[model samples]
Target: MATANTLERIFSVDYKSKIQPIVSLCIGGWGLENLSEPNEVTIDNSTGNIYVADSGNNCVKVFDCDGKIMFKFGDKEGKGKMYRPIGLAICRDRILISQSRNCILNYQVNGEFVSSIGKLGKGELEFINPLGLTFDESNGEVYICDYNDNRIQILSQELTYKAQFGQDNLHSPLDVKLTKEYIYILDGSNPCFHLYDYNLILHKSVISREHKLQVFIPFFFFIDNSNNILIITDYYSIAFLNSQLELIHRIPITQPNGVTVDNRGRVIVVCDGGEHHLNIF
Candidate 1:
C-alpha cells in the first residue's frame, strides 16, 4: 500500500485531470430505467455488477458495468417486500439491505429471499432504524449502522448476532465502512467521522466544522482500494481525505448521498436530488 504522502502527492494534480465524468445513469423517475432517491450503492467486486438501494421506489436495482439495467428486486407486497431501503452491502453470495422498517433483509445475488432480522427496539439483535450495511470479507461478518440505537451491530453472514459497539460515543451513525485495519463511521448527529479499530476501540473523531471545509453534514462515505476516503456531504460536494484523515481535495457535486469506488478506481456517486442520477468518474 502507498503511504498517505504518496497518495496526497498523486492526488495533488489538476482536479479535472484526476477525475472526470465517465458515466451517468438512471434519469430521475419511478420507472425501472430511472431511479428515485437512491440511497446507497455497492459493487460486486467479483462480477463488477452495481447494486443500488432505490429507496423512494422501494426496491434494489442492479446494473452491469456499462450501466445497463440487469434487473431489480423488492416488492411492496411479497415474501421479499421492502420499505424505503437505504443501505446496501454485498457479501460472498448474498445482498444485505438496511431499511427504515428497522430490519435488515438478506437476499441472494439473484434476488432470491434468504432471511430478515431485527425490529423496532434497542435490545440485542433488534434495531430502531437500520441505515448502512458493510461486510467484513475477511471475517464473513456484517456491520450494520443502527441509526436510532446509536451503535453498530455485527452479524454473521448467516444473519445471526455476533457483537456490537459504539453506543458510548456515536450519535445517530448513518453509515459504517470497514477496511482491512480500521472501521470508519459517519455520524449524522455529531456531523463528524469516527475512526475505530478492529476491537471497537475509538482512535479519533473528525469534526467537519473544525476541518475548515464547506461541508454541512456528511451522509455517506467510501474507502477505496488505496484507502482514500471519499465522503458525500449534504452541501453538494465530496471531500477527499487521505488515510491519515487529512483533507486532500474537495469537488463539487449535486445532492450527493452515497459513494463508492469500482475495482478500476472509478469514483461512483449517487446523487439523490436534482438529477437523481449516478455520476461515475
Candidate 2:
C-alpha cells in the first residue's frame, strides 16, 4: 500500500472529515513528542501512565497519561547490548523487558533493576529473539512471543511451562496482548493476526489484508476500558476493530508502530515517516 511519505505518485484518501474525523487532540498540550521507528506502546491504568518502546532509542519512555515523558529507561545508543530491545509488559508494580541480548529482566517502578526472569537460548524457557510479553492477570500466567521460534509460550508466574501455541506455522509472531481469557498474536511475516481462547484452542484469525483472508500485520493493539474497541497498529496504518474482530474503521498513515488510547478515547499513534509523526485523533 502507498503512503503519504513513500512513492509520491500513490493515491490516498484522507477521510479527515468524510468519516467525521475530529482534529488530533493536543497530547500534553505541547512539545516535540515525535519518535523514530517506534515499535510498541501500552497504557497503564493503575499509574495513569503510557509507555512506549522507543526501539530506536533502545529505551522505554514512560509518559504521563496525557503524553508527557516522565522518564527514560535503558541505554539508547545500542550500548550495553540493549540493541533492538522488544517486548514490554507491566505486572503489578514492575515492568518486564525482553531484551534481545540474553534475558528478560524486571524493574521496579522507580526504574531500578529487579532481577532477570528468563534466559535466552534454544532450550526450554530459553528465548531466542523473544519479542513480546504479556501478563495474564486473571491467572497470573506469563505469555511470551518468541519471534525466532515463531511460537507463543505460556508459562506460570514462576516462568514454568504451561503450554506452547503456534510452532512452525507461525510466521514471525511479533507482539502479543491478552485479556482475561484470550491471547492475541501478531504474525508479521504472514501479515495476519491470531486469537486463542482460554483453552488454547484457536478462536480464529483476527486481522488480515490478503484476499479471502486479507489481514494486516498488527504490530500492537490496545483495548478500551469497555473492551469493545481494539486499536491495531502496524507499520503503515492504525485500524479500529470492533469486539468481533471486524475493522469498523481504518486510518491510513505513515510507518506506524506504537499506539494507545487516551483518557478521552482519542487514538495516539506514533509514526516514523521521516517527519517523526505522532498522529492523534
Candidate 3:
C-alpha cells in the first residue's frame, strides 16, 4: 500500500539479535553429517527438535535441540519410501511431508508411514505438484501450497479435503502458513508476499513497488510468536515486517531456501546453496 526504500526510509527496525550468525552451528557439525540438498525446515516447538527435508538424500532427518541426530527416515523400500522429499510439517504426533507423488504423506515422529492425502489430478481431493505445507494446530487443518495447481488447499486433520483459496492472484505459490488471524502466502510467480485473512480475502501485498521495496522476491517466510513476519527473499536479505505488514528490518544473509522461528523466537534457516545445511540466527 505504501512504498519505502532502504535508503529513503526515515525509520527502520533491527532484528540483529534474532539472527546471531557468530554463535551458530552448521548441519554436519554435530557428527551426523548426512543431509544433502535439504529443502524446507521446521521446529517442534513443544520439544525444540528440528526437522529437515533432506531432498537429495531422499529422507527426512530429525535433530535434537543440541543438533544431534535423533533419527531419520526415507530409506525404506516399496511404496513407503520417499523419492524426493521437499516440504515438511509436524502436528501433534504426526509428521507431514510433500514429496514424490502429488500428495502429502503422513508419518509418525518415529518415521512410520501413516497415510497419504489427496491424489494426482486436477479434481477436489487431488493435487499436482504440492510444495510447501503447514499445520494449523489450533484448527487441526493442513494448508498446502499446491505448486502446479496455483492454489492453497485446506485439509482436515483427518486429511480430508475441505476448501481452498488463492486461485485468483497466485501463480507459483511456494509456501503457505496460517496465523491466528491471517494467512501468509509466498507466491514466487507473483513475486510478492501476500497477506490474507483467515477467509482468504486479499488484504495487502508486502515489499512490492506499491509497498516501497522494489525488486523484492520472496522465497519463504515465517510468522513468529509475536506475529512479526520474517521474509527471506532472493535479494539476499530477510525483510522483517510488523503485524500490520509494515516493513521494519531488512537483514542481509546468503540466499536461503527455508526459514522458521523457533519457540524461543530465534531464527533458523537452511542454506541449500551454501556450505552449511543449517544455520541458526
Candidate 4:
C-alpha cells in the first residue's frame, strides 16, 4: 500500500521448497523493525496470513509468509480505541482477542467486528484478565484462560458457556491448546505445560527447567499435525517435544514468544528480535 521504512529481511534462500527449513530465527524482520512492541502471534493456515498482537502499538498486524507487512490495526498508546492488547486466537474463520481492563473482542475473517462476549466479573462465567483464547476445532468449543480468575472457560461456537476448566492451584493458565483428546495448558506462573482431558481433569504435566521465562510465559505454544508440541521459549528458541515429554529438537529463535505451527508445518513466531524490531519466524 503505502511506502514505509523496511527493516532487515533474511529469508534463507533454501527456505523455499514448501516450508523451507528454519535454520535459526536469530534476527527479526524489518516489517516489525518499526512496529511497536508485540505480544503473541498466530498464523491463518487457510490464508497463509500471520497475525500479531502489537501490544505496545495497541493493535494487530498482519503479514504474509514471506514476512511482508500486509496491514495493521490499533492506535498508539491504545487509548482512543484499543487498550492493553494481550492474547489472540483464531477459530474456523474469526479471530478472538483479549485486551486489558477485561475487554473481550472478536473479528470475522474479513476483519469485521463480530461480538465481544466477555467482561470483568467475579462470577464463574465471566473473565477478569482473559489471557489466552483458542478454538477446539474437533469439539466446536473455544477454550479461554482467565488469568486473574485462575480458570479455563470453554464455550460453544456461538459464545455460550459449555464448560469451565481449571482451579485456584493453576497459577496462570496462559494458553489453551486442544489435541484430538485433551486440552493442553501453558501454565505461565509455574512455567510449565499441563494437560487435561476435555472433561477438565488434569492428565499430565511436563516440567521445563529450560528457562525462567519459559517457566513464566509459555505465552503461546501449538501442536503440529504430527502432534509434537512446538513450545515458544521465553527466550530465543523453540523446543519440539513429543507427547512423551522428551525434547525432540530445539531451534534457536529470537525473543521468541507467541508461536504456532500450522497443518503444513509452517511456523510463525512473534518477537522483538532486536531492541525494537518485530520479527516473524
Candidate 1 accuracy as TM-score: 0.90
**Rank by TM-score (best first):** 1, 3, 4, 2
TM-score of each: 0.90, 0.77, 0.85, 0.79
Better of 1 and 4 by lDDT: 1
Candidate 3: 10-residue stretch with minimal lDDT: 1-10
Clash pairs, candidate 1, are none
Instruction: Please give the clash total of every predicted structure, in order.
Output: 0, 7, 4, 3
lDDT of 1: 0.78
lDDT of each: 0.78, 0.63, 0.71, 0.63
lDDT of 3 by residue, 1-281 (tens): 11100111112324655555533445533234566777788887668888888877778888776667788886467656786788888876888999857877789877888776777987787888888888887767888898898899988868888998888878889888766556788888757778788767998776465665443666666666344444554447667766656677666776677777665555667766555557766
Residue 89 alpha-carbon offset, candidate 1, angstroms: 0.3
lDDT of 2 by residue, 1-281 (tens): 10100111223323232233243322321233545555666666467677766666666767775566688776433223355556677766777777777567666655666566557665677778888777766556777888887788887766677788788567788777765456677788867778777777787774476533334556666655254556677556667766676666767776666676554555667665666554556
Highest TM-score scorer: 1
Residue 19: error of model 2 in Å?
7.7
lDDT of 4 by residue, 1-281 (tens): 11111111322211123222442333233344335556777777678777777777667778777667677665343222566577877766888788886866777655566666766885755888887777766545678888888888877877887777677457877777766666777877767777787567888776777633233335667665344344555565666665565665666655666776544455566666665333433
The true-versus-predicted C-alpha distance at residue 59 of model 2, in Å, is 1.4
Task: lDDT winner between 1 and 3, please give it.
Answer: 1
